[model samples]
Target chain A: MTSLAGLIDRLEDAVAHRTPLEKEHVQAVFFLFPLMFFIVGFILMPVLGTLYDAFMRDVIFLEKEFIFFTNFRYLFSDPGFWNAVRFTLLFVLISVPLELAIGLMIALVMNETIPMRGLLRACVLIPWAIPAAVSGRVFELIYNYSYGAANWLLRVLHITTEPVNWLGSEIGAFIAVVAADAWKTTPFAAIILLAGLSAISEDLYNQARIDRAGFMTRFFKITLPLLKPVLVVTLLFRTIQALRVFDVIYVLTGGGPGGATEAVSNFAYKYFTAGDFGYGSAASVLLFVIALLLSLFYVKASRFGEA
Target chain B: MRGPDLHTIRRRVSGRLLILLCLPMLFACGRGDAETDLVFAVGGAPSELAAWEKVVRKFEADSGISVRLLRQPANSQQQLQGLMVAMKSKQQNPDVFLMDVAWVGLFSAAGWLVPLDNLDRTPFFGELLNRTDVYDGRLMAAPVYLDGGILYYRTDLLEKAGMTRPPETWRELAESAKKVQEQMRPENPGFFGFVWQGAQYEGLVVNFLEFAGASGGIQLQDETGGVRVALKANLKALRFMRDLIWEYEISPPSTYTEMQEEEVRTFFQSGNAMYERNWPYAWTLHQSDGSPVKGKVGIAPLPAPEGEKGVSTLGGYHIGVSKYSDRKADAKKFAAYVTSKEAQRMVVLELGWNPGRGDLYEDEALLERYPHFGEFKDIFRKARPRPVIPYYIQVSNVLQTYISGALARNRSPESALEHAQIEIDSLEQRYGRNPEGGGGQLSESFPYPSFTHGEAVP
Candidate 1:
């Protein structure tokens, strides 16, 4: 009892003689409480709920029973899930490198001494500024088989005798969707690369020039090596985004032409919309794990942020 | 100025903090007004909503109840998803739901809709009211409008081709469409023979159902008292659909990518296709002054195979009071009002929606305005409902996928049907035979209660 009283006395003394740092900490906690509450309540809770739902049999009006790993077993055996994974990987493989190369070229051009460089940079970002859904609709129009600009251009150039059904076949739909996605997101990569380029010291380039290095040589050795961290970061973001590609594909083809363009996210969304929440949640959890592994691989492979 | 004491500062800060916390609560409490606001959730084109808004105003004035119209996603699948989410969460804001005909069984089976046993359904078409309105031995929804797949053709082109009547068989229609296309190709280079909703969506399922029904294709059969897929007729129908695109070249290759009703309507309205299979609403659009086919359009029942009668897939919207609604009485009142004969007449005349009431089809003014209400009534009477099972969404998903694959030439019709049958069987086993507890009766027979018709639209 005496020790308890002594502890209480110590606590009261500390409170009465609180330091400025302690007062500041209390104030910071008060300010951050709402934000912390929002993050935990909205984001964290839903994620945990999804994980919980993944291990249960959840259908509408049916009793939800805890059936551990059954949903995962169904997913593993489901051809649609595997098809979605294949297409998602194919999309990432095709779109990310094209985005990186085209983005790097644009960033290099924007970094050079040129007239109206700011305007040019702004114009390059127009595609990215447009919402993905709106851009998707625009691309849908552009790829229309009967009256699209693409076919008109092809006809005017005398390239083909007939208009191509850009979204009517599997490979055609896949290519068209990939092009649309790359068109909308390449500018984002370019902007990031441009930022990285700006951060590199101009003196380093001058020093390379003094060493009689050619443009190609300097590009390979200096720009790429120095831009590694930014490139890794940009690739990680784009890779994750590409794996879960949905909006453009949903609007453009709706994973049609025999589900040729369905991404993992689209597949999960289908199950979710169909009210098979358990299977959908399982697919989502698998997607989360894949994304985590991919991000880890990228970080490790690039030795990101290392000297 | 005198310096404030520490206690006073603490009290002031605490008071401000309390108000900040209570502000949201205060606003929430402020929403409790005397006037009851009933929310009706609906989906469709903005123009369709505009037509319904007039009806809503009349109802509001008569009942002295304010209504907030909540517009849902235009896509039917997305709309269904949104409603399912809201109902799953038991939201009470949407007192009334404007549901597609197919959703009546699913929603009612899930116990999301209130049973409107007292609503007088005698005025509605017997088939629609009996087949789609009832669920688990209860009248769950009231039909607001009736729709079915109809064939729209170019009258001028058919006349030019020396044909006075629309073709009645798929073979005949194909020949006529090809003749018209070849005849018109010299003048209109963009012309095609026929167009329909071939996209891999619900519309595709509706189109397939029409063809399948006409060809005597039963999706499910009672074989030895066990439900099984009847594959032969479905395979034949699928082959015929595929031939429309690849073999006959009647439909454009782009049909594989078209996803909505509007796409087919646009092709037909632009005078690019000789014939279009679509819902009844397309007739009004095609007859409007802005359409290229205005005054040149004709409506008829869809062509069937040789040994069968023409069949149209049943479709329309029904109004139901949400089980979660706080104002069920008001919601039921609104539902009853919108489906009343007077409102039905106005909607039918103005919006080109087929009235649910059988007697309205025979009204002199309505027949004068529409001119083809007789044929429409006949089609609705004989319209075949898509399988009325609670797991219909999943079943339709599987059907559309395989049917689309067959149409796209990604898989043979035989293989596609085989695959689809397997998937559908699994869906049945997983979800149970019938979620509606209807004893897995295949809906081949009219098992629900029937109403006496005032007058048949012969």
Candidate 2:
């Protein structure tokens, strides 16, 4: 009976010790206030401000009043707004896949043993390293109908009979923008895949080779299955980038050749820069929503990268 | 010259290095950080910047104000954002800023500029320039050196083509260009027809307006003055531009959507263009020895369409004190000083800018010093403002959009103009204008590039 009581007492003591202490967590609480303020002030406040501004009646920032989604309601009828969305989606859908394919090819090349491979990897980064605006202007020069090196080279090589207007036609300008973007950004994907490739074991490839596997057989059986997480991660990163594509399109076309290249960002810029704060905010919020939805869809469609 | 030891040689070398280090300070470039600092911004190639640098030095010497010239975009939206940011940051360093005349209207409406009426204490800012800066009777931005569009032609090319005088009509111009371009010199594809700014902006409106004016189409009829029809003329003028690209093929169709100033000038300077429509700045820059057409270049009024009056709209940067500026007094002083007779003389003569004052143009002494003033003063008198409305930007945007479509996208000029008129009515309605300002009107003073319903005469 005493032994049983002693055991009960020990168990009761254990429960008593298990109870959490009531000591002040001063450090965490103290740091948390400013952090919360920062998040609210910088992030939440601007987001809400954009949302609030979108519904304003007048374009004049201070003069505006709550018109309650009149901007969006008007936006549905606006051809310019629709044109921007359609073109922006087209830019994303086309540019993203091309970039991914080009990126994967380059990544595969970099994965192979080659002379000065480190130097070659860095060289590939040169295009990606330059600022987007700078690259945009550079591409503008490249695509200039007159005195553009692109046409000059083509003419020199006898590839075409006449100087093709890269920016003159709607589809041509669209393709020019996509090509410039792909050229600027493919290295980002390459580097991501390179990291993924580095993690991939050569021993698995050796075993597959010993099993008399063909190139495709080895790739599908070994490399692709292992690299799925990294591939999805690289793809997600590229898609997010592709969705907000703006500067290159802006510098290349200025949404010209009759609004052929107008992106959501360009539309937002035209309004915001013109001080049409309300309309600009509506366009910007719409852009943000589109980007968010696309990102969420991509992350989900990649099956949380577990596939 | 004693044979120096290593120590002596090192000391001499160090002394020379010190002199080189102090050279900038000695030149006074380093001395004036806080001295009467003023910020003036302009946009152009580097050579143009050199002209403003001279203007700044003169201002510094005359007024004892240390000048900080901020060279940024002349017409970019970044300029507006930059000004707003500076105002918010409370930076008073740049005392004076440059603003385009059209931008002045928008900026003035925002009440961002100090009323020039308040600057009455200064003798430099006369009432005439100040009065024009006002919006709704409240004074804002002041006109600095103004700009008006002009046509530049290759004298040699025109003479070679046996057209003794420049074309006075669009048809004559196109006919002459087609003749000149077909007889391309054996060595080069010399003398293309024409070039002008055509991207969707204020520049395009000017091009559209000039043609419309020259075409005998009228926009706002001085109902009292008998057939006030400027906008209609503006559209007729635009159709001429369309015909030039699509019908004549004399003008570079590729340039219909180009928004560059220098690109057009380059073709003219390279002696590949017979006639080019550009601002006076192009004339100033093209007169240099580097231009193949320098000695043979001719500055003439733009061709009027079919016996109509030639009209050129005023284009320029204006100086204004910010309403939000704490240093409003200093800002007003700087504005007036820059526009003063003496400063005007220096600016015109040295910087190749046209002076706002007419008297200076005739001032024999000033003309003796600067000869171009005598030449351009006649042109300056004819400078007209675009339909000076608060919603002028909206008007121009619609006009430019339609014109670009008509010219570049191959839309018929008539269809484009008709579509533009409908768009203008809708835009005006959105602005809460009562269609015709409630005059039971035939038309709502549509400030678009004017066109006519009448068929093009064969």
Candidate 3:
């Protein structure tokens, strides 16, 4: 009877010990549940579904059939697909660095103790704040062949007698796209790099000044190296975003002049809009793979820079 | 380690957060299944939408059926995308909608449209009804309006050049344009000989078809949907189109890059072009009070190739009931009322639109209002439609690229058509109903491409 009573007492003690601990764990899980649900439901599931769809003949009005790698095979053979890839890659290679360079310059300008700095920052963000579609239309007007600002300026400056066909020729369209994209995205890069720029210790700069380091010397030695990590992150972010570009191109060019300016995402969207989901999914999956590889490369390079 | 009050507050906060997170899902799932009002979707310029709204109100008053007017974007492609989204998910709203004629093939094949067996299709243009709305031996939609490409010539410019009438052929048009452009250029530097839809969009395809002319024009071969774009007639048409931009220097360089119907019309209306190729709707706008060429504009059938008869491309909107619609009866009632002769007459009178109904063209009242209606009757009858296949959008996307490339002088006409043929062959193989029957080679005939689920393919 005494032993049985002792066992009952021990059981009560165990319950007392475990209840709060278990409660805490359960509460923690509850806190995380919403985030996990969103991640799984929206992002992970659609990505997996798209991956699965890439292997199927998922066209409208047709029986959905598993046609493994066939869509990808077709994509590889498609010249339009290759053109899109070439355009996207070239765009990234040119525009990303151009944005970073311009952004860094803007960040440095904003970092200085200049008058109306806050107002200047806000004004700079206006282009970035506007939706891409709206800004694309604005750029469309700016680049209009006949009476647009682009031509008006060129004529005023005596750059050419005739209006340069901005969205007509292949190279002209390419430059227009890059310039428009750079204008829209450079502010985002500037804001991020400004954060990095500010994070630098004032003491280091003071020491550099004491050591009589010139502006160029200080910028090369201190600013650039310190800004490297942030630059890599910004590069990865911009590259992924640029690879999936659709809205600006859709509004500005409609992938025109014989589709000289069509991006991979725009190409995929065409298929999706056409109800050829399998081919569209395959295109998206290829783009996704490209982005994944590029991000991975950026990650490795960042880690190397950190070391 | 927290006190009981703190723990309770944390739990309450988390509970509220969870509810907040679930709120969107709850609202998203709150679809009204017992909806009685028929949702009729139509898109156009604001004025056009307002006219449609009036039609819907009249439809409600006439049929005692309530319809919810769902306004769509003015851009046709954006409207198609929105409709595609709803149809893809099999949504019950948007019970009825206006479909671009080209989309009829895609929508019908996808089984998104309810077959209108009871619709009195005799009222609509018979050939158009068959070309655009019929699929699998059933009428899938009813026409709402008819649009066809026509030539808009500057009468004053022609009169100034001492040309009594508009050019009858491409050669004659060019000769007249060159003669007038030379005379007019010193005074008006912006003036050009011709303006057309040379931009890389659907209009380019329509213009190309018109240029190909009625004889041996580029068309879908059959239900199998094979197309021979590299045919001799198509080649000649493409070369002439390119020469107008680069060789003859008649059409502006921007024509290949920027011109669509609106751009072409505005350019011509602004007195920059001697001749313009555009749809019939532009006639009213060109003749509006403020237009520079208001009184000087004249209409004619689009000029054909030297030997072939000129034919405009068939374009219009068709209204159909959705297969997924819960209110199919109401939807059909509204559709019928909208396409009825009375409503068509209202559309013509109120909006200055071309009526889809065949009988409206014969109406004495409409004839008095729009004398061009007589000319339009002939153009509408002779109009050739774009390829009527499920994959036409995809096919157009391919052709838009190659043809625009050719016009931009990036490649020769021969190479452009050859490559386009190759690309289209593969598109057929991928999306064609019978892959084995329709791939690689451009053929003259293919049995109508029909979709049957899981029966044929291995």
Candidate 4:
């Protein structure tokens, strides 16, 4: 205790002698050190390790041997890997725009000053709040060929004479996967866009009203231009998330129906579980590179910083 | 006035930061237990886990050794993954665990399983033990239970169709299925003639093996692990499976899309089908008190092509001790206890599981309760396992894609098999043992001490 008291006394003297700017600099570095340590330990190290593993033969029953680019060579020629890539890209192309459009309308409705508006916003998030795996199982039941809601409703509405095989056919499996994913993730897009919508000043709408502008005209001329930055951010975020889609497809289709709905993530995970780490790592590294390139393109195309 | 409060807040924040930095150190050094209890990992349905718990308790009481029962995920895939992670990192706790029949090849080759030569192997089936449990000419695992594909037919429906016995050939089975379907369609629009596992999974491969007749499919050419998959028999079987869905129209379209073991079982139990192919466990469920098919189901060997004996795919869990266990002696004792005839009988009586021991088939009480045991003995004896190779899962994945693709009519069976054969060849070259002895480091050496029979416990 005496030694601690003496050290505190010496620290007070040192603090008094040092410039406040230097002390502030020390505190700033002290605060940032932990964050930097975590970033390096958790994120950076594993990624680099995976990059290293991709170039080695790391199967569980095999000896580790450094073989540069061999795994990538095999992966590129693999029809199953290509099939997964095509499915993932096609999924993003369809689901992203579908989600954005649905989310925009939802954001528009939730932005209105209505009764129990807060409750409505929270309720809109319920599907998003549920874990993707849980929701995927629910959707699996919903698409059941024998007694699912989709077929039952179709029969009731007289839309078709027979029950459509929703998860067995390639096209059916693709559609089911997209619909399930959009249902789970659209609310995230909506919440982000809702914040952007709320940030738009009421005065802008008031000015448009005074100018005798219609609602559509005001939205097109003012709202969309101002919302461009947020839209770009949401697109980039959702695109990255969609590229790495795994849990929902895993639970629902299991990359089944002849591998029609296998995404790149699921493809990589299969190899990993099968104890072929080198092949799995190579597949994942390819996905990471694609995600990085796409994000860069989005940023460059949108001129996000200037916006 | 604000300077003193701000100073204290800064101090508090720095103190918290220090704690945060030390947090990882705590976790890094956290596992300090001088743990002596044997950790046994097992996974199954809730009822199966409860049965395992009872068996564990009995062993603990008899041996005077405490045992920890670790419950893993019910899904076999997840269970394999959990064991892989623990074994790869070489955690010693999961001293003993249950392994799916398919994983024995990988686990044994990876040197994760401890040798068990001391235990008496007299009771277990010699063929199953040699096929799955033996590696490097040494015993590495012991069978805990057994499973095989069986033909389930509705007795009343067969009798109504003026048939006294189940069909014995694929052609006959198809004809009978169509005959019964035509008569039953008017009463139940949802009725079909047959159902089996055709979804893209491990079960699909097993069904294909059975369909390929007694020799099964995919021959391992030699010790170097060369595989031949595009065989004439496999093509015939694939075409017949596709015809069952489209040509004969005896099975539902969903057979290729969704039918698994449980799905096929439920369909047959609901009286929607005349013939069903599934595991032996489904019999108990089909004959349950409230079931629609109670006392109306009959079991037989799956039908094969002409002039060939029917084959069932061998499947079940095996108990093995981890090589890295700190408590191998105790773990081995537990393994022996689990595989002992008494424990096996208890498991069979309580859970309705097929006993891993062959002698149990002759037990009067068991046979009295389940007369079907007499029929299963021959089937189990002849059940052909999927190739017991280290990279069987990868090979199975490739097979799953192309086989289901053929069933789905995406390609001709010949072309699908051709492409699948090419993919599997490359996989074998990559994962198989290399001539230089640099790849597929199968544990061939045993420097570790082997257990001695009738040894005193320390």
Candidate 5:
């Protein structure tokens, strides 16, 4: 016990001899240690564990054996895996642009000097505020074949003689899911872009107007160029999110109509739930690689932070 | 030195604060005393769960053992997934599992379940008890309730169509449904001839099994040495199901999208269809006060193919004790209690569950309360179980995919079954050989005892 007390005294003397600023730096690091430990333990460890599992052959009720690269090789050959990849790309390609365009439009409108601007901005966020699962259910009800509001409006408008099965066909289900996702996420993108819009000086717009610039010209020149950084960030985030879409499609179609809407995440989720951890982990690793590559491309293309 | 300055004091205090902050986590890391409370994972409708709560209360009072109920997801597939995760992790809290009938082979082969070979089986129906509980000459689970697929038709519509009884064959049923549809269309313009679960899910597998059984077809035929996929019977069943939608135009195209039993029930209960193939639960729902077809529905055996006996797919929950359970004795007692005739009677009287025991079906009071209980008992005795193999989930998933593909016109029934057979064969090769004595070998066909139908009650 006396030796332990002497060891503590020596540690204190070593710390006391350092400069006050350095001592403060040491204390700051000590404060962050617990948080760093949490991230490493919970998040990083599980990620590494998944990566390690990807190299094995594991199925429930069977012994796990190390078969490096075999899972990936099998996945590459599986038709279902390729189908999921194709649909995931299609979903991301369609939803991201639609979300960006609508989000920018809403953000521009909210940037205007209008009455009840705060209320309007808050109201625009309501759809985004609803949980994705709940919104998926709402969309499910709205797209019901017999009693949905979509068919009701169409009939009231005399658009068709019969109610359309919005969620029963492949193309119809795809379009319906994408529309639901876009509706749920556009407001979030709008809020982000709105912050960017607020950051731009009002004087710049005034100068553009004085220079005889029209609305479209000023938006193209000033607004677009200034919002590029924020837009790129939003695109990167949404692209990653859209690539991993599961809940809405699951609640909406369950990847049905002959697996037309099966995303990569859904495929991996199915395998994972079926206790094929090795293959599921392999699929997830591939997804992570794709997401990482896309993020790198965005950062390189935008080049926003360099300056 | 300024006699241990403020900087030294601040550093020591900060270090003490950090240690204090971690104290709760340290305490949390300590494992508590050996758990005495038994956890049972169960899934059912809200009303059924409420009735189960009363039964549990009684058991707790009688045994002095505390029980915690872990409600599982309503979807069967999701519930199985949850159980698999828990069992794979070897969780000791959930001492008992309310498993689906199809899960017996999978859970037992995984070594997640405790063998209940010593339990008395005399009170239960011989066939029902044997088919769901036994796996590879050992009992792994006990029957808690019995559910079988039955045909429900609009009694008033059948009467209007000059049919005094339900159809006895598939062709006759289609003709009757068409006649009823033709008569009822003017009054209810959106009327459909027939509706059932045709989606790509576990329900679709059950639906197909009934059809295949009635046609004297089997998907997996367990022979003396190995298992073989019955491709021809499966193809025929798929063709018949597809024809019901496209060739006959009796069922709607929307059948491909229906995911749960509730969807078909909703359509039938709304008075939109003349015939619906569903379980006995729909009978109670149909007779409920809010239903449009209240007291207008009749239950009957599903129509068989010509010259064949009609068979329903056996469906229900089974109770099993988890191998990882700490309180095995208490868990076993609870399992036995739930399957006991007394508790089963309460289940039937209060929750409308068909009792697992055969004698309870003959009880005068139960028959009086649920007039259709006798019919259900007969259906239960005749119902055939799905393939009892450890790889049943994989087999069912393949069938659901291919059968729905055929129904959706994406592939011909021959091609779909061909693909399904290949997939199932691979599964059998991987898991069916019973390596390591996991007891997954399908070495013989299930012994299905035949029982003569009793006289119908007036």
Candidate 6:
């Protein structure tokens, strides 16, 4: 038979035994739980709200109804909605490739042993640092027919005799918006690609040079394959930023010289401000779904896992 | 290994309590503690802010109520969008709102404004009864100083262009623009003949309305207190504007995209524009001591096109009490003081507002303070308020968007006008009329169409 002390000792053993320290595991959970909650609260909440609002009837101020795909039906039926979607898609398709190419070229240039690399790096950031609203306002002046720098420069180059009201004409406005958006976002893409370029081991390039591999061959084979992951990340980030483009388009011509530049976000903002919370939410949902689909397609095409 | 649990339990308890306690503290933070402090709201423009801040100081001193004035920033759509955001706060929407006259119909229709007709029984009520404040025969809000658009021309430049007086017709104005462009701005290639608000917003509607009326297009006409839209006249006027930008190239293409009265003023002040179509505030600011255009400017009536009538868009704001205001009695006192004859004089003499009362403009002393007062004040008297229907805001947005698209997107003007007329008809049906419907109509001279049947267009 055990004594009273012995029984107390056993009880204390049951109560006082502690698990080993899991600093890494605890640290991971501490960081992850908050990040998980933030994703759910800020990003997911709005996204879910947008989805529900998309399908419901817009009964201003009342508890909205579940109309079972009516809003989507309306969205599909509207020409304006389709116009915005088509324009937005074309914009993404045109801009993404051009922006990506330019970004890579810029990254290559900056990565070289060139003089004034620091100045060039800082200069590259200038376009990205400018707020879209300010950029839009500034470019509007730059694109103005009478006073704008574009026409002045064009005149100097002897491109056209007459002033091109870049924002006044439909095609001019389209190209102008595309050019402006690309200029601002290319810097972001370049910075991302530059980071990827810097991470590459010097030994690999040296080995390739010893093997007498040409610059293009080396770039296409080793560098391209290795940079695939970073390129994917840059594409994902820039596409999302460009997909929901508003500030520049809104400020420049307000989706004018006749809605030529009305992105989905601009359309969403109009309804949102007009007190049509439901319609606005529906437009937002459409944007979200399109962005999601595009992201999924790009992620698959880029072979994120395989690469 | 054995570890301390008691401290852990204590920390856990405190953390849980802290989380629970945070919510009520947040709720408390949201509510106001100062019962005596009054917050006043106003839209910002240099002329108006200077005037309003002075009024705030004087009101706080006399009434012994501490007034906190918050000025709304100036940006297209985004600035106005901020006001809608502040409305979500149960504590914030100002006690006394400086409501834009254009938004008076909209905010009231949404039941955002507290009906002040029943709120007041003051001597100023008589004048209030006659104005646009009483929508559907309910006194929706109170009037502050009034605003109206007029032409600001370079007087010296006009005389130099061989025009002895202001152009009385659109043709003459265009001729004046061409003559002035040749005379003064030939060496300076960036200059424009005229600068006006042409963005797809309310200002565009107002600016377009003035041009339409001047071109013999009446946007709205009331016959026996019932309204009918004279769509043809409006179409003609819009076509003229389309021509003004496209064919004549008098008003720059940027005008088709510029959103506010201030932008026109900016271009004018820079000497980039020969004439500007803007509100009375710009005219006042130009005459101020520091103005670059102070001694260089002149005022004139917006000329008619062909054999049409001289008309300008009625532009200004109304000072209204919010529905959710806790201190209704105190707010009424402030409103009374603002719309009073003496207060109007203060605004006119100090800030250059064309007060709602017609008599204030006739005061010689007030006229002395504003040298160009005689012409702009004369222009204000002839100005017309926009279609006061609540749905007009929605309808106008459609009209302006399509019109802008036509000019910007290269769509036809005729089709855009036709589309607009049809859309407006549908919007008009949603409005509820007063018991004495069609009670008061301006004479048949104003000829905008009536929304007889609210039906969708093809």
Q: Which candidate is the best by DockQ?
A: 4
lDDT score for residue B447 of model 3: 28
Candidate 1 Cα outliers beyond 4 Å, as residue runs: A1-18, A304-307, B1-35, B60-66, B219-230, B434-458
lDDT of 6 by residue, A211-253 (tens): 9999998899788889989999998888888889899888887
**Rounded to one decimal, what is candidate 1's iRMSD?**
6.7
Off by over 4 Å in 3: A1-34, B1-31, B220-224, B437-458
* lDDT for each residue of candidate 4 in B1-458, tens digit (9 for 90 to 100): 22445455456545555655676788877965457899999875888878887888899899998998888898888999999999988889799999899999999888899999778989888998898889989999988889999999998889767788998888888988998899988878778999999988889988888887543444333344565566666777888999999999999888877899999999999999999999999999998999999989899999887777788889998999999899999999999999988888888888998988899999999999888899999888877777778999998899888888888787788777767766776676577544343242322321111122222111
TM-score of each: 0.89, 0.81, 0.90, 0.90, 0.88, 0.83
The pairs that clash in candidate 3 are B223-B447, B223-B448, B223-B449, B224-B447, B224-B449
- For model 2, residues B290-313, the per-residue Cα lDDT tens digits are 767778888888888675667676
True contacts kept of 6: 0.33
Q: Write the per-residue lDDT of candidate 6 for residues B1-458, one digit (tens) a residue.
A: 43456456334433443444455778787775445666677777676778877777777788887777767776535545766566545453477777666667666765666666544434332533344677767777765766677778888778867887878888888888977876655577667788888876678778778876775655553443323333656666777778778777887777776546777887898777778888877865677687777788877778886777678877667777766667766776787777767667777777666776666666789878765667665666566777665545555666667678765637776656655544343333222232232332212221233323333111
lDDT of 5 by residue, B260-375 (tens): 68989999999998889998878888999989999899899999878988889998889999999988888888888888877888878888878778889899999999889888
Ordered by lDDT, highest first, the candidates read 4, 3, 1, 5, 6, 2
Second chain alone, TM-score for each candidate:
0.86, 0.77, 0.90, 0.89, 0.88, 0.81
Superposed model 5: Cα runs more than 4 Å off: A1-18, A304-307, B1-22, B31-34, B60-66, B221-230, B422-458
What does candidate 1's lDDT look like per residue over B1-458, in tens digits? Answer: 32344454344444444455667888887785433689998876787788778888888888899898889888888888889988998778688978888888788777888888667877777766777888767889987778889999888888876888998999888998888888888888778899999888889989888887788866343433233343566666788999998888888888978746999999989889988999998887888887888999889999998868778898988889999999988888888887888888877766787887788888998898878888899888778777666778777777777778788888888767666665665566556664454333223322222113232111
Backbone clashes for every candidate come to 0, 19, 5, 0, 0, 14
Which model, 2 or 3, shows the larger DockQ? 3
Q: Report DockQ per prediction, comma-separated.
A: 0.34, 0.09, 0.34, 0.39, 0.32, 0.28
The local lDDT score (0 to 100) that residue B30 gets in candidate 3 is 90
Chain A TM-scores of each predicted structure, in the order given, are 0.91, 0.84, 0.90, 0.91, 0.91, 0.85
The all-Cα superposition gives candidate 6 an RMSD in Å to the true structure of: 7.3
Judged by DockQ cut-offs, the docking class of candidate 6 is acceptable
lDDT of 5 by residue, A1-307 (tens): 5754675676567567767765675567567767866898899999999999999877776678887887786677555678789989999999999999999999999999999999999999999999888898899889877677897899899999666767666688789889999999999999999999999999999999999999999999999999999999999999999988999988887777667778998888877776678888999999999999999999998885546
- lDDT by residue for model 3 over B348-399, one digit each (tens)? 7888888889888889999999988999998998788888888889888888
